[model samples]
Target: MIKIVSFVMLIVVMLQGFTLESDYNRAHQKAMQSDKIFIIFLTEKECVACNKELMKIMNAKNVSSLIEKNAIFVVVYKEQKNTFPIEMLYTTQYPTLFFLDKNELFSCKALRGNIQPKELMNCLKLR
Candidate 1:
């Protein structure tokens, strides 16, 4: 009985974690409707660092909470068909974090490379 209960609890907890939208247009529209910033995470398929950084964000309670409260988080893979404006966010690197305001403008400087949890929270708070 205890094992069954624990498994159920674990499933619930995992389901409560932050979710990233893969559709740029839907995410952007939701962000505008919610009056929150849009956070775009650019990653590649074979990037170990990007996966590590994504794990950090997912594991960090503070970062995840802040993002959930104030931003629309979207993950766009390099090889995927996405609607992200390449001119605005041209990057030669993986794991880039771009924050855009409710008006669909750049909120602050883009963050590149691996970012710690606290650093992600700080960056999100800046906008």
Candidate 2:
């Protein structure tokens, strides 16, 4: 009975930590280190262009590959979303890509519209 109880408890704890929201925060913290870059996705729910841009980024193999390796990817939903800081830091742009080096400085304007995977990959490399 004790063994089963412990196993169940472990499973519960692990499951709680598996969410994307939690993972995003953890990765964001790590990106503060010099070795990592942060690629933040600011999105609005009602924007058609934003949705299209997000789809492109999601399917972008090269961008995804680079992001998986050396960058922290954060998806922030704006326009009265629950995330206060994201709403404060960003605005109505449905899809915005904010790049930051390890120093967390604002590197460029929010990249909107459809983005090519290779272009995003090249941007990160330049960072």
lDDT of 1 by residue, 1-127 (tens): 5346335534543565655776888989999899889988888776767867776676677787888888888877877776677744568887988888876788867788877676677768886
Off by over 4 Å in 1: 1-16
Q: Write the per-residue lDDT of candidate 2 for residues 1-127, one digit (tens) a residue.
A: 5346335534543343321222345556777753777777676655667656655565555655666676766655664334324433645444667776665666544566566666677767776
Q: Could you say which candidate leads in TM-score? A: 1
Per-residue error (Å), model 2, residue 113 = 2.2
Residue 74 C-alpha lDDT in model 2: 64
Query: Clashes per prediction?
Result: 0, 0
What is the RMSD, in Å, between candidate 1 and the native fold over all Cα? Answer: 6.4
